[model samples]
Target: MKQANSGALVVFGLVLIAGLGGALLARGALYLGMHEGDTLHLLDMALRMGLHGQWPHLDFMTPIGILAIAPIAGLVAMGLGIGTAILWAQVLVALVLLLPLVRMAGSRFGGLWSYVMLGYGVVLCLALVHGLANPAPSVSMHYNRWAWAIVYVVLPLALLPDRGRARPYLDGALIGLGVGALVLIKVTYAAALGPGILVALLVRREWRVLVVAVVAGCAVLAVMTALGGSGFWVAYLTDLLTVAQSETRPAPGGIDFADAVAGPANMPSSILALAVVVLLRMTGRKAEGLALLVLAPGLFYVTWQNFGNDPQWLLLLGAAVFALLRTDQPDSRHAGRLHDAMKIAGVAALALTASSAVNIAYSPIRHLFAEAGNTVPLLSALAGQDDIRVAEKRLYKVDAGVPLDGVGQPFAAYHDRADRKELSRLKGEVLPACELSTGYNAMFETIAADLEAQGHAGSAVLTADLLGSLWMFGDLKPLKGGAPWYYGGAPGLAAADLVVVPLCPTTEKSRATILAALEKSGWRFDELRRTDVYILLRPVRP
Candidate 1:
């Protein structure tokens, strides 16, 4: 027991040091204005909640979606601040999850279990960092990210042994609830964990747990339905069902689809493959764990693909691997030699785990190295304490308006009292309609055209990132500070007397044809702007 406590201490210490180090590094970058994706969105949601007393979707004033990054937001609200809280939240969730797995491994294999947890932690943190960089808005924003993090912790606890059987039912119920929370958080990994969840259920064969999970899941869904409205729930359910109908979808433009297999998923998928081995070699209930371990990833991979092999998904994946590799039979005479082999394997696993740690740790190290890149201007931008005149230039693009395209909200920072205050006061759910009336920028012309074709011309258009396509192509009149479409200020499409739309003809012939079309429409064809993107306008009063 003393030794076990010692081992736990060592692991705990390492985790703390590593987590703090990682947080400090990230905080520095954040402080220096090195903002990543979802950073803005998450902060926006928090500011809306904090400054405005809103609860994610309940705060309809801000045309943003739900505060899916709730855990982070809650931490931030509690005064832990933003970036540090987010990083620590990820680490803490990972540690809570590792507890059960370590216990299970120790129950069967002893000290080696710690090593396995350690290794898995490394892999998960590494993968999480990758996702952290350009966190998909839903995935990283508010409660959504936290919910996924909880899923990472909860699912592993469920699969681990119920040590003393105290609350196998509770554990199972918690797993279900966590999973249910995840499903509601965002449909991001709903598809990826199918095989994994199945494997866990089949392995545990605890129907009560499943019932608890179902009930918990239903309760969460019911609450969301009640709060978000039946129509919203219907749409949410429909979107989930639609995505599930297809096993794999095309990767977004820049994201790499291939990374799905190389990361932590390898662990779960490997276990599934090993389950075949276990079923063939082991006997009775003893073999059930291994078999289920193997089965889960296989089933999950087929059912949900978005997990895209993210490292965090490996929480159970690592446990399954350890389960499969564990030998149930006693060693007898070769026990000493076998112990040595186990020790060696444990060490090797720790080393492998260190690789994961390094992967996660690498971000901070890189950021440290990039520290030199922080100039007076960047630091000023980050501190939110820059010289007003210089800071104004960096924060508000003279050319780009308050809300840039693709970056859905207006005001680079939600601190833009004039805009965000009104946005946060909204009474109910708000979905920013992406339509042509927002204005024509090079970045969203295709999207704008689609909206127009769908008869949504007068709807507001917002993009996640203004690709600077609008400025190069369109004759869009400047709105307030920057280009028209970029600011958070809602272009009162209802009130606009005139609006411009641009189309870029790549080839000379195509350009002539487009010009001809414009001429035929009886609208004047004027080459008012020149760039890679083209802009056209229509008089609203006409």
Candidate 2:
């Protein structure tokens, strides 16, 4: 009892320090702007879903995040400005949802291992880091990330070493529902730690409990499908398949072996630690112990799936510790050593988390400093050149590993180190193109096109990209101002008297197709100077 109490105190201290440090760093430096790519597009869809009282799903090709995720993010944005509120909200939510899992584990394991599991697990670690720095931290994208932690990671720990008096089936079902909810939010999450949960449940011989969970999940899904239409099923399947492809498919930025090995190594030492527990379980050690051996693999698989060292990985550690803590056998002499080992691990995990928090907090500033330091010296040396523009031109021409070149040009590309290399490769390549007249795009373009089709052509025509600068265009504003759905399709092409596209090959294909369609409809293309983006024109109808 004395050792357990001591372990609890140490564990609490470490988690507190890690959590507090992460929260403070995230609050200070990270800005909340959505870029033009994945995060922006996902949030844009979420906003529309919230406004219209429609839940987004991946039907046909429309991208819709999970149900709980989108609304939570949309509500947060509504209450606080979208950019500033999102990052904080994500961290708070991850903590709120995860702390319970840790406490539950502590209740079962003794405080020592529960703390280590919660603190050092890959899911929790990754999420804490990701929450602090990632540009978009809306629950929409990261919701499943957390769900995986709770369902596969934490819930399994909770189930093992059951006290016999507790509500096992109900608890398991609720945990399953949480996982199901994650699947609904982002189809990508359907695979995230799901198989692991199944494996754990089976090993525990909780087959009846599993049945209850499945039934409850099926019932909820049925209700949703009935209310939402066939589009719901179609979208769900589409999202699931797409997510599977993305995970399994090789991309330039796919798997990194070093990240895999280094991430989970600190917490657990050997298969022996796990092996002893399993042997004891089968050798009448503890029922919970035997169940845990199966559960551990699921947790590892989930953590391994997220190769980028995201903060969500911490939850996996939390789950593992929870499992360990629950296995405390009072008669075993090794309990004292286990308690001491866990305390040391907890302390070390806390220190690592603190360092991680600092690294994430200063990442942007570090990048900015590195870029500025190099540029300042060269500018000073070139200060005396007669043609300042010439010096500037020369400086701009230097390949900065970005698509945008030339000094003083509008819409100059900001090179993001994270995606620049891959994005540059994708620049000229034709993608698996999204046609303008389908899914959400269809809905958006239809509304915009209706305005033009009904002789509202004189209204200011604009695309989603120009939404922020709506005031700059003309007196005419979007029927649904700043709604991104209408930004890319036939509506975006036809609503405006002028069109401008980037000069990249992808843009060229889109621009060419759009222009050809417009000319076929008797509209004339008045070519405007096109750079990386686009510019096109048509005569006023008399």
Per-prediction TM-score, please? 0.53, 0.54
What does the lDDT read for residue 211 in candidate 1? 69
Can you write out model 2's per-residue Cα lDDT over 1-542, one digit (the tens) per residue? 11134345345635653554354344432222222223334444444344334445431123344453454456544654333333444445445545445444444444345554444322332332233345332222344344544553345443554433455566556655666665565444445446555665766677766787777667767777787777878755754454444322222124443444344542342242364454445334365454545545444444444434333334333334434442355647666666555444434434444544454434333422222122211112111211101112222332212234323444345333324222211213432222221122222333344444445454555332312222112233433223232222233344455443323322223344433344455545554433222232443432
lDDT of every predicted structure (CA atoms): 0.40, 0.41
CA shift of 24, model 2, Å: 9.7
User: Which 10-residue window in model 2 sums to the lowest lDDT?
Assistant: 381-390
| 1-542 per-residue lDDT for model 1 (tens digits) | 11134366447646754754464445342332322223343444443354335554332222222434555556666766454555555555555545543444343233445454444443343223433333211222234334444554455555545433345565665666666666655555444554556566666676776667777777877887787777665545544443344222233212444334334534443433354344424322343445445544443442233333333333334443344343443545654554444344434433433443444434434433333232333112123312111122232231322234224555435444434312210113232322222222223434345445545444332121222122111222212111111222222233322333323221122223222333344433232222333343332321
RMSD of candidates 1 onward, in order: 13.2, 11.9
The superposed Cα distance between candidate 1 and the true structure at residue 491, in angstroms, equals 15
Angstrom error of the Cα, residue 374, model 2: value is 23
Cα error, candidate 2, residue 179 (Å): 1.7
